[model samples]
Target: MKTLTLDLSGIYTAVTPQSIQAWEEKSNQYQQQLHAGTGLGNDFLGWINLPCEISEEQLSSIEEAARGLQERCDYVVSIGIGGSYLGARAVIEALTPSFEAYQTKHTAPQVIFAGHNIGEDYLSELVAFLRDKRFGLINISKSGTTTEPAIAFRILKALLEEQVGREEARERIIAVTDKARGALRTLADKEGYKTFIIPDDIGGRFSVLTPVGLLPIAVAGFDIRELVRGAREMKALVDESVPFAENPSALYAAARNSLYQAGKKIEILGNFHPRLHYIGEWWKQLYGESEGKDHKGIFNASVDFSADLHSMGQWIQEGERSIFETIVSIAEPNTTLRIESDEANLDGLNYLAGKRVDEVNKMAELGVRVAHIDGGVPNIRIVLPKLDAYYIGQLFYFFEKAVGISGYMLEVNPFNQPGVEAYKKNMFALLEKPGFEAETEAIKARLK
Candidate 1:
């Protein structure tokens, strides 16, 4: 209900009733295609949600499992790649600062991510840092045959065994892999390891809100219920189209696609708030991994305005016309930051005293608009009233659904990563076997 009332059609007078109806119709059609959108199920859009598929008991079980991880292990190394890792990392970074992962007095246990890559130096460092610490591994993969995480798992498991003893190590480890079988699943069963399902309906990228995300969030002591509830609210609202501005997610997706079709090739996801930088990263991966093939869509990149203004801001203002930025600018705050008065009026800075951050933000946004319009740049600003577990839940789901629709519109498979496969094949050929002899020979011939 609260979501159905928030206004957010920036620069426009108000959202139209007709517009809302169109979005509702789209949502209705999408509900049918959600599962069909990917090889997994309907809500498999980003491996998020099961549409009342998972029970409260299951959520509790995941919460308990996180506790188990905390109890038996000093750290957890999550081994997943692409969506598998990015979604969880988004939540982690959004809700918890990177510094808080391993510090603070009341730590919910430490987690260090590994196995997403196979660089020996990186793996060796993780192995070295975690040598004597009691750590468990939550190895994620559908096939269990993936090169990166699999290699990292083997190395980490060996180290875990040495530290906790193999039997104890097995107890500490958990496998969120395929239900029926995979190399990871088989190894987990043989080792008598703890288990969690990656879900038959959910894909790795979209699995964050499911056990995939729940495990890490619960393990980190975050309010997992709030997060899921937020997503649930988001899903419910996408189905309703009343009050045009209230449906922030639908409006955003549609407008973005409109901009892309108009020859905009880059989306700069800028946020004044540094905390939401990962929302941009999540967006980058979602759009980049989803629609970046065949050169059919705009490239998505992220920037924090105040910080990047010092570096990449110049080209954005004066460079060749290539981008349409989607700025996720929040209007309201979750909490009030005082606009404290300046007692000692240092420079002529007293004019800025007692101005609410929201006020300062208002002026900054106007400047961007003036500059962008003058420079012939199109901008679609995503204005969130506040950042909370629920609103972000809506935001993430909205983009994931939009990306799927955009891909289908592009006549491409948004779910599958055929292009990413090339890199993986090269990696395996180089790492597992001797090398890519033919490619190498070609290179040598070129040199000669």
Candidate 2:
């Protein structure tokens, strides 16, 4: 099976070979720290070997639970914020047809997401839409108290119970949360909802190989075993024993950090395939949250090419030289689509009549890379053999491993997100939630 590969040739001009070699040494130390559990976020290093560590029994259990959900529901609402839903959504969107929701036929339940936002109209419309459809809820949170998802689950729970009655609704809900504690775990235990434990050491962003991501992808009818196998294969290829030059993950970490050191602060993850848009979303969260700390790290951004070419192309091509791009290149599209010859040739597209659509896309991609490089942007390309469960799995692990090494290169603790609580504290204070009386008063005074 072909795997995902990273090419840093395009970035060589912007980041010298010597710089990459130096960063590779640093990345090696970081990789060692990760394996030895001696790094800043050592406690969260559970994800370091997660791909290889997942057992067959666990995979079976996850599939079994997903099968139950699939047998019962027409739609499955995966509810979580950030890593919780992003990974699952990324895999599902990449594998499923773009118009699968509108299609009359589908083998698997159509998976949708909620609890990632607090949009009033979004939640209202979701509830209204679920009124007639048979839907199951996959509520994911370490704590059941994350405001957005908590509110969504509350409303959805009530509606589901009213629609199907309490007993059946309990059976339809699956809670993926902490094993020993957390409000969600407690509720799952008490109400007898199917449950999966999110490993205590794995943070949300790195939990894709865990039940957090696998179950949803499985529920959507993708091959979870192949996904896990692909991740495991990548785990072996990027192991500490693999040389820095040969390890794609290490090279990626080294190249990106080298670019950052050279004053390129923004990393744009650009993809030509639209299905990969959410993969970009997931990548942003993975790198942004993991590396963006202590007033440092690259600004992670993304754009879908050919489409965003018309929108953000100008800025990316001629914007500040601080920006660099990493493009995800798909080597082969899944389906064949030829541009047929037109007799009239009025629109003047006849020159490319016999070519496949993907051929044109590849040219556009190559053209953009050359143009962007000329206009002062460095480019990194990650080539996937094809878009499938296995390659996507390989891609996920590649980024996850690279981010860990990259974050350590930036001298920050990637696992813990201390900055995320700043807004939560203010929101809770302004809302006068229970124990924040002093903060509430202080915030009110500041507001006045």
Candidate 3:
């Protein structure tokens, strides 16, 4: 791991050592309570080590499923909310070019996400486009009872039945929910849909590596074994004995919050690797949900360095003093296609010479580093050696542990998202159920 120590001078680098120590102590105590009978312990974070929990194996199956869906369908609809869809969407969108493309190495996977929101126009348009077309649905919800995905699944299943006439629709759907059983589990078995589990020990946001994440990523044609390998490596290497002050993950968690205490109310994460943009989304959920409480702490945001250099980059270079940036920098590209000399010079007269992209990238990074330093900005860099399965796995595990420790340091339950459930309750009340209309009208009156 290439560790970049961010200079915290002039910015508040102070932390309560006693508080940090207390968090560590609490984390140690909760390790078993968290994992309980799973036998995975905190070292593996929320991952279960059983053969049934073979993340890599399931991912391969997911890929095969994805290919099957792709061949038979015109579109793939993802149904889930919160961490379920965000992490996956963030990854897919981050890797893909912002402007839609007509060409790629692979047949593009057109992924349409629903159930995250119940927008009438949004769901309505999707339904119209998908009308009588060949499409498949992948729904990720720990409980089949969640209103959003549940509703979307009901609608899509009805459509599937109409298209395939009930018999074939059963095989066209996949469900990723709880391991033992939940509403989703029951539906999967009853409806004859292929199912995957979001490991029981893992909470929603932390359930990324499990089926919650793998199913989507695998469907998008990402290499899942490499992903599992990356995570597994982190499980093997990181230990509590690694000095707290020097432990990369712990140090990262502590320092950012330390700045928060000093009145730096915004933390920006910058990623150099376009592929890992979703990891930034993963980070936002971790930091924001864990720290955004009791009228306290910084807001987290992410930027892709070179691409955003033209837009948000302007403000960041001369932005408000509220942000302390964490640059998730990558040292190498995943694939290097050499830039050939422009023989035709259709766009411009060639000032270009024989040059590897790495050379140009190094120069750009140097320029960004200097500008950031000059602006009196507090920035730390997380240098990933390369973009691959192993490194991403390491980054995921490292960040997950950091979030847990950071939550501990902040005295927040990072593993829980009670606040997220609040809105769902309100939505449930509004939806027409047997006894909902009266209470819903009461709540709606308050809004008025």
Candidate 4:
């Protein structure tokens, strides 16, 4: 099978081969730390070997649980924030038919998301819509007390129970949370919801290959096995023994870091494919939370091409030179649609007739890269053979590995996200949640 490849030819204008190679020793040292479990946030390194560590029994269990949900419900709501929901959502959206939302039937439950936000109208409409549909819930959390997903689960669990009764609802709900503790695990044990463990060693953002991501992608009717195979392929290639020159993860880590050292502070993940919008979202969370610490990580952002070409395009082209782009370029599109000739040629696109839409899009991508490179933005192109469960699997693992190497090279722990709690503290204080009396008083004083 063909694996993903990295093209750094466009980046030499900003950083040379020697510059990137300079980090090889340091990058490999951190890579060894990751393998030896001696790095910062080592407790969460379960994900480092996760693609290989996954057992056949676990795969069967995840698939069986997915089948159970698919057989029972028309829709499955995956509830969680950050890594919990993003990984599954990214893979599902990438593989699912773009028009599946308009389809009347599907092979598996149409997976939707909740608990990632606290928007009133979003949940209201979701509840009202599911009132008549046979829907299930996948409540994902380590502690079932994280405010967003907790509130969503509370409302949705009530709805499901009212629709099907608590006993039957238990059959429909799956809780992916702590193995033996936390509120979600306790409720799952008491209520008898089929459960999967979010291994204590793996953090939420990196938990995609685990039950947290696989179950939902499986429930969405994609091949979890192929996904795992792709990830395994990447896992082998990124092993510490692989030389840095031939390793995609190490090369990516080195190149991006070289660019960072050259004063490019923001890393924009741009994709030409529309379905990849969520992939960018997933990438942002993965890199942002993993590396955005100690005030030294790259500011991660994402853009959808051709569309963002109209809005964010201008700024990216002529804006500050502090930005570099990593474009996820798909070599072959999964489907094909040709542009037929118009009789009048009114739009002057006749020259493009007989061309596949993807061909045009690829040109737009190449054109943008040329323009951006000329405009002082360095570009890194990650060419995927095609966008399938397998290659998407490869991409996920590739990014996960690169971020770890990149984070360690920057001398920060990639596994933990300490900065995420700042907002949660303030939000809890303003709401006057118990156990936060001091915070509440301090926040109230500041507000006054």
Candidate 5:
């Protein structure tokens, strides 16, 4: 029953508790703005109550679609970028076995991702790998015209059709896109592919709870119901009515802003557990895109611990003092392994004999905290009771809610990513896309 909790004790050295507490009134005001649909990006606030709004029928439909994919394909490629695919991939990677690729058997189709980038070799290798495999596609895009996923869908759709024949391939592809418009929606309607609606009010990064994330997660054989339940619980806990003192999201938003004001410009999300790697990636996108605007947001970064302890640890310990760390600490691991007494003790790890591996990890995490704090870097700790579908759900919602408040505190539109299109226009012009003829001519002149 214990859910995600945030501890700001590690941050007290850098910014006083009173400074963080001062954000209480402002944070609550922002939370109210989100609820009342009065904020700058209020039109895209559908995700605020999404968990509670999702009816039983919707969950069942997604589950049914997932069941079909599970039954038909040995591998399922989830094609999209940013929020579209990060949420599902984060959850699946957290729950999946570390060495799943080497596993001899699987009860559900292995889910893979694509279209996040335009790497030719990556696509080529993916095509060659899937040539002989029983695979399917879940194409996610609201516009179905995003350059990366659109190109990927084109290539993969042809491959799947060739392998399974066009008629059967239609059944293998599911489209999560706009309800009534967009290229993907048009294609799905024409081709008769099973379709799910990506809500108009919900932006891509926040679309995880919708069919955009649910269908792929369910297909991965995880419990979507539990995940939604956890998010609903968090939604209630972080509601504007809750006292700021007891609200995890409010405190997190406040603490982060407090540090940012105190000259800590970079937040490095660190985790001791390896399975949670994508969670960091997802968190980075959530915070970075939501808050990194108006030239006034903290830089979000991440590191995988114990492993990065060797690589990034030195820099963190003695590098520039502008960075602080927020560590996601898991209290309990899914499995257990204890160190055993070795007769030779050749590695000198005998001192750890009879201790659970988690114990050493915990000690190392504590040691790092003390070292970092002493090294003048503030830290924030997010404790999850266990890593499961429910906790992951809670974690995702916690960050989502906090980032909304944080962005508001920083005076930026949390939901809109206007700067993301600058590169696209240039890329299209360089490629001589018809509509960009003027831009193409200008760019060619500039190059000369």
Candidate 6:
């Protein structure tokens, strides 16, 4: 099986080969810190070996539960915020057909998401849509009190029970939360809902290999075992023992940091493949949350190429010189499509009629890289042999490992997200939640 490959050649003009090698010793040291559990946020290092550590029994159980959900529900709503839903959604969107949501029938339940947002009309429409469809809920949260998911779960849980009775609702709902405690876990136990435990050692953003992501990807009918196999293979390839020159993760970490040092502050993840859009979202969270700390880290951003080329293209082309780009290049699309020859030639596209559509897209990809590089932006390319569960799995682990190394290179704790709570505190205070009375008073006085 061919693995994902990284090319830092385009970035050579900005980040030299010698510079990358110079960081090798430091990268290796960071790798040692990760392996030795001696670094900051080491407690969350469970994800470092998660792919290899996943047991066959766990895979079997996830598959069995997924099978049960498929047998019953036509639509399964995966409810969670941030890492809870992003990883699974990214994988599911990448693997499933782009038009699966519009399909009248499917091999497995069409997985949907909620609790990630709190839009009034969005929740209203979701509830109304599920009114006639057979649906199941996968409620994911370590603490059941996260406002968004909690509110979503409350409304959806009531609807599920009222629609299918409490007994059946109990069977349909699955809780992925803390094992021994947490509001969700306590309720799951009391209601006898089938459950999966999110590992205490693994943070939410890094929990994709766990039931947090696996169950939804499985419920969508993708191969979880193959995904894990690919990730495991990548895990071996990027281990501490791998030489810096040969290791993609270490090289990527080094190269990006070198670009950062060269005054390039923004890293844009550009992809030609539309299906990989959510993959960009997941990547932003992974890198942004991990490294964007201490006021020091590359700003993570993304663009869907050829499309965004018209919108954000001008800024990227003529704007600040502090930007760099990383492109996800797919060697082969899953389906073959050829541009048809039109006799009228009105659109003036007949000259390239014999080529596959992917060929044109590949040209656009190449063209953009050249244009962007020429326009003073450094470029890095990641080539995937193809898009599938296995390759996507490899990509996941590849980025995860790279972020770990990159975050350490930036001297930040990759695992902890202390800044995320600032908004939550203000929101709670403004809403006058019971526990935040003092905060509510303080905030109100300030408001007045």
Per-residue alpha-carbon lDDT of candidate 3 for residues 243-262, written as tens digits (9 for 90 to 100): 55456666666666666666
lDDT of 2: 0.92
Task: Give each model's whole-structure lDDT.
Answer: 0.69, 0.92, 0.68, 0.93, 0.94, 0.94
Per-residue lDDT tens digits for candidate 2, residues 167-242, read 9998789999999898998999999999999999999999999999999999999999888888888998888889
Taking all chains together, the TM-score of candidate 3 against the true structure is 0.81
Model 5 lDDT tens row, 27-113 = 889998999999989999999999999999999999999999898999999999999989999999998989987988998999989
TM-score of predicted model 4?
Answer: 0.99
Model 1 poorest 10 in a row by lDDT: 6-15
Badly placed stretches (over 4 Å) of model 3 are 1-45, 48-74, 91-101, 104-110, 180-182, 335-352, 431-438
Q: Candidate 2, clashing residue pairs?
A: none
List model 6 lDDT by residue over 1-448, tens digit each.
Answer: 7999999989977878999999989999999999999998998999999998999999999999999899889999999999999999999999988788887778899999999999999999999999967999999999999999999999999999999999999989999999998899999999999999999999888889999999999999999998999999999999999999999999999999999999999999999998999999999999999998999999999999889999999999999899999999899998998999999999999989989999999989999999889999999999999999999889999999999999999999999998899999999999998999999999999999
Candidate 5 clash figure, as a count = 0
**Predicted structure 4: clash tally:** 0
lDDT of 1 by residue, 33-77 (tens): 654554323344544345345678988898888989888776788
For candidate 3, which ten residues in a row score worst on lDDT? 3-12
lDDT, model 1: 0.69
* lDDT of model 2, residue 426: 99
Estimate TM-scores for all models: 0.85, 0.99, 0.81, 0.99, 0.99, 0.99
Model 4, residue 401: C-alpha shift (Å):
0.7
Model 1 bad stretches (over 4 Å): 4-32, 35-51, 97-104, 240-248, 334-344, 356-362, 432-448
| Number of backbone collisions per candidate | 8, 0, 3, 0, 0, 0
